[model samples]
Target: MTYTVNCSILLTELPLLERPAAAKAAGFDAVEFWWPFESSVPSDSETTAFERAITDAGVQLSGLNFNAGNMPGGDRGLVSWVGREGEFKDNIDVVAGIGERLGCTAFNALYGNRQEEFSPEEQDELAARNLAAAAEGVARIGGTVLLEPVSGAPRYPLLKAQHALDVIARVKAESGAQNIKLLADFYHLAVNGDDVAAVIEKHAKDFGHIQIADNPGRGAPGTGELPLGEWIARSRELGYDGYIGLEYKEPQETAFSWAIREHAAN
Candidate 1:
């Protein structure tokens, strides 16, 4: 039941290269992040520099996301989006390469928002195909593909745990690869009004990773109503021993007292 900080959400005031060090300073020995580069296929220099930053920070890289179109903008993901398959595929090798360098095995692949031009069936078909390919590519490095149900975007089809699991099953059956698993994010589940505890009890064994942010504000664990600490303990009771990613928003200079408290309590 160790913890890893998500630099993409925490420590936004610092430069990307410095975030790993910041997390380390905050008592975190591991961290995860979304795609840092704007380009799907960044140059070797950029990739190397990123790897160096993490290595020099002396923290383990726990998880990384495959390229999702424009995160800061409105794009939820790109792999399932029509006409963006090429770009999404182009990022697989890059992500896998970095994952190999960082000793990171968990990789999240976001299912893109629904497109009006494409029917639901078309999107599902495309997602399954692309996810299968992604699963295969990451398998070369002994990496696992993570499917997460995101909140706040209605157009995104995978908003419920069942939907994400269904997609994972489809990809596995279609690709004959078993490296795909679920990324259970409690905040997203609670935000969508699902019984988070019930979902965890049923799918804990299927989870490859877990992330958390409190409901109402998507902030730190203690900032909202979710009993994240209890939920985390429950997850461990159910046999999930993986890192719990702290994927929550925080002020630029806020202290991670909540994490310290949780660690002490555990």
Candidate 2:
């Protein structure tokens, strides 16, 4: 099985720039991250340090998020925010540069929440255009822009696979970009009441990427009742060959026993 540690969530005990090395030392050859900087356009010195961390650590940067503002502050993303479109657009070159430098090809774009000042139609329209722009920029590196259905944000409209797929279709039609795809995160889909099995059974072949955290607590797999091993095995049976991102929150030391348990069961 191919697995990549999501350093942004799992390695909270370490400083951000140190996470890729930590992940490499933990036996993972690949790692992923959310936007690693606060500013949309980080200085060259900052980016240079970041790239150095990954290269020195000998780890592949598997996936990254487009600048999603203040994720810990309840902001999901910037694409649909009417006043921040410039920031989102400007961040694309940085995201593309990172992807190209690291040979990373999958990028997630979390759709911004529904703003009170705008109608749903207004937000959706803005999202499609912005997502198309993101897709086009990433496409230059042979990358795919991912749309993920998130849980725990009431204002976020995408809570299921189809919701994201609809936006993917919209972006393709509007911009003639075919580089967009759904990021099927089982934990979010299950928490939001979607039939996760049916989703994987029907569309696993098309998923841009997959992420997992145990249900109920969003912890590592063994801490919850989710049949994650079976689901992942099934997804493999259905031809999803991409890395399964371990995007759970837990103590890094004991977090991966679940993988060993799942492997024994398989």
Candidate 3:
């Protein structure tokens, strides 16, 4: 089966309510948002309208970005999960509810980077505990949580793919939640100078979705050095059928449409 291309609305620069329509106009089968609560328009009302627009446009919402660091800086600052268990549970419940209502089956999140000097073991333990808690909540709703690896994030203290996989395995084992998965951001892979297909092959079992953009400059395809068509073909050869989110900053407004068509043609 052909993999569905989900346009990352966050990279589209379009307002939440208008994103779904615009993505459909651009020929994407699905649209993804960062966090609905952060919409420029009224949260509740705009979210509902956003849903309607997607349905009207016949676009599916494949995933959401959950939340960002403490609003200012830090990695995700899933800070709410740090000391207050109740608060963390409530937050996940709310986000999961929103995801369910919006038709998002996967929610990508950063585990609030451990920006301080904590023992490597301690950091992993904290991440494992937090992920376990979050995964349990997600599993209750049949939703999956995707842990993303970003540069300079403590959550990825061990930046290499092998280390990341080990951590992920431990987290899933401890969490007792098999619904959790990995979000393979190809941009990061390129930055690390790793062979994207090799890494994907190594972690295909844990990987659920992929976000792609060219290296050096995280720009749309054709404007960068990545051979996206070859990568897509490799993925297909491996029997991987999943959404490939188009998340990148376009050099020009007209560039995105051209890029998407180019990518689709491949």
Winner by lDDT? 2
Better of 2 and 3 by TM-score: 2
Q: Write the per-residue lDDT of candidate 3 for residues 1-266, one digit (tens) a residue.
A: 23333444343465557667767675667877665554212356755675687689788878875555343345454522345444445567666766677667787766555545556566567767766777776676678877766654545454455555666688777756787777777777677766777976766545777777776577666668887767766765676577877777663365466555767887
Residue-level lDDT of model 2, residues 116-204, one tens digit each, is 99998988998999999998899899999999999999999999999998888988888899999999999999999999999999999
Q: Please state the error at residue 252 of candidate 1 in Å.
A: 3.6
lDDT tens per residue, model 1, 1-266: 58898988889988999999999988889999998899999999999999998999999999999998888787888878999989999999999999999999999999999999889999899999999999999999999999999998878888889989999888878889899999999999899877889988998877899999987899988899998888888889898989999999888576488767768987
Query: What's model 1's TM-score?
Result: 0.97
- How many clashes in each structure? 0, 0, 0
Between which residue pairs do clashes occur in model 1?
Answer: none
Candidate 2 C-alpha error for residue 30, in Å = 0.4
Q: List per-prediction Cα lDDT, in the order shown.
A: 0.90, 0.92, 0.64
Cα displacement (angstroms), candidate 3, residue 129, comes to: 1.8
Clashing pairs in 3: none
Per-candidate RMSD vs. true structure?
A: 1.2, 1.2, 3.6
